[model samples]
Target: MYPKVGSPKKVTMKWLDKAFAPLKDYLDAHHPENAKAIMGWMTYKGNFDDLYCYENRMTQGYIEFDRSGQLIRCSDNALDHEYELGYERIPVKTESIHPNVDRWIDRTVSAKKADIFREELRLFLQHVWGPMANYDFSDLKANYPLQGSGSPYCLYVYPSRFSKMIAFQFVGDEIVEKNCSLREYQKFEKSEREFMYQGWHLVTLIREFLAFEPDLSTTREVVRKGCEWADMRIDENTEFVLTAEARRMLEELEKEESKK
Candidate 1:
């Protein structure tokens, strides 16, 4: 049949280990490859009242084990959610088939895939942003404010100011690596119309270009083109308006040009 909560007891790591020990040993001995893949371990937590009270409420945790019986990753949600009754374990009905055992296996596989995705995304961000260890950033946006073409892209603005903005484009769900490009804000606006007509989903707009030390020449060229485009737009159209920050950046560019 199914397991039932027999009694409530204070949950602890020791209790979780004691409960999952048999399952861990079984998986390690029989499914060594799967155990090693998921980074197995056991965890537990107790439920207690906010006002210095203790309630004997707990829930079973998920665990994974390697062939050598080493722990990898484990977690329990007992203290996070109410379990109605408490934690209890059903005796393994069959050595080869059981719902509880199957559930943990599924969880382990899912966790492994999730970890892989996280690591990939982390490396992708680092490659695109390039050693962001020193930059102060704010006004972050991820998968929101859908573009007019109904596509969402990630954005990260630095220094909490509108002085510079970086837009990231993605192909499907994966980021396009080493593909940073820059275009004037006005030119980008014009291009968006073309993109919308052509059904293109990704676009990057560079309003103000910030120089990176030990710079990549290609990135600098793109930023330079953006600045040149903005300068042409300003000179050709008296009606074109610039944001306050944009205006300041343009003036600074003018001063730098005069010095050269």
Candidate 2:
């Protein structure tokens, strides 16, 4: 079994707490209109060891929105099981520069296995988050295609005057127009139809852009698809999808982050 790192160092907790202190203080001081949303996440209940374990299993890097609405980044610990995955329950000693050389061969083997797992996980995360992890959204202009009457295929043409660009598709000369919005196109309602609605999907995409603050290409792609999906018009009889334009953009967004 790997050696334990003992109790967490006070300094580490201090730094961690300090990381969220300001945001927590902000919510306590001047409450914003979304104060409820922000305040609800102020306290985190998970153990770091367990948290790291889950993160490792998911192969996700330790970047998450903390309870205080602050961002915490877990650096890639390729050699440590817990660090690599984001959980802390591994039997191996973590944060220890010195390992028991008495069992050098076994420790070395365990470390190697751990390293392989970490590499696989890192690759998975890179594929999932994509170029948006590296790019910013301010660089791209909206270019949603105009869906003419009755056509199934849609495209992005330009930014909208209001929150989103509106596009139309047609079937049998019947014109179907969809209006798009950048944010909050319509107030959120609690119906399954409304929740699963394309408009909500667009809003989610916008939130993703703002949350990650990805690169220009990534941002533009997100905004473009968002606009395209927002413009799609669906009816009781209309075959509805998330939209190819939107899916393509999302695919690019989920491409490998590392150029290599």
Candidate 3:
């Protein structure tokens, strides 16, 4: 067995909390309105007793608004498993990280909270890209994309007013289109979301970005298309994956600090 690294919660929390502080600090300072939650994960490097296990190295991959309410912070000990066509998924024995490194929380609640955050980014892209809006996401889907779960929230797009770039808010199955000027949209909703819906495993750090010139290429690529299944990957490499990048930057900082 691998050497114990404190408890799972303690070890994971130390890095997870600080993995995105600088970026988050900038966001809260400038764009408190667009404050966002960053979710990330890092697996043990290579095989056990190797680089990461010998000297902890952090990997970065994050998706904003992973789910509507609960953003699952996942850490998979990929060293123990392999992906084969017939490989059986080994069932974990406990909720503890030592025996079971995989962690996720799927709480059933309103997805509307994340729907608004999702729309904010969508609207921004729609306005800036204009004719080139679909360059990134053509449509928005609920974070938890399950049908008939009593969470009757559907993500529908608004026809562009191109006349004035405005962001609309959803209200009881209707869009509040009239008084939702872009300026007001940007200013309001200051309290839309936080990093933790309710913390578990000490994952409680937050971030918000005011301004950054982003390059939105290679966010998602069509990989291996079968009749009905296609593989899609999202990580810091993907476009608009800010949270992942945030954690990565923090880890880079940690590496630098350690050398000192």
Strongest candidate by TM-score: 1
| Tens digits of lDDT, candidate 2, 1-260 | 11212233232555444443544454456556554454332332233542211122223333333444443454363112322424333222123212222132233224433332332222212322224334222222222232222122221112233343332111111111112111111221222133244353332222222223233236456545765566444545555468889998877877854453
- Candidate 3 per-residue C-alpha lDDT over 179-233 given as tens digits, one digit per residue, 9 for 90 to 100: 2222333322221221012210111111111012121211111110110131233
- Writing each residue's lDDT as its tens digit, candidate 1 over 109-138 gives 244433433332232233223334222122
Segments in model 3 whose C-alpha atoms lie over 4 Å from true places: 1-3, 10-120, 123-140, 146-215, 220-260
lDDT of each: 0.34, 0.32, 0.27
Model 3 has an lDDT value of 0.27
Candidate 2: list runs displaced more than 4 Å: 1-58, 61-198, 203-214, 231-260
TM for every model, in the order presented, reads: 0.22, 0.20, 0.20
Clashes of each: 2, 29, 2
The weakest ten consecutive residues by lDDT in model 3 span 199-208
CA RMSD of all predictions: 23.7, 25.4, 27.9
CA displacement after TM-score superposition, residue 107 of candidate 3 (Å): 19
Using lDDT as the measure, the top candidate is: 1
- TM-score, prediction 1: 0.22
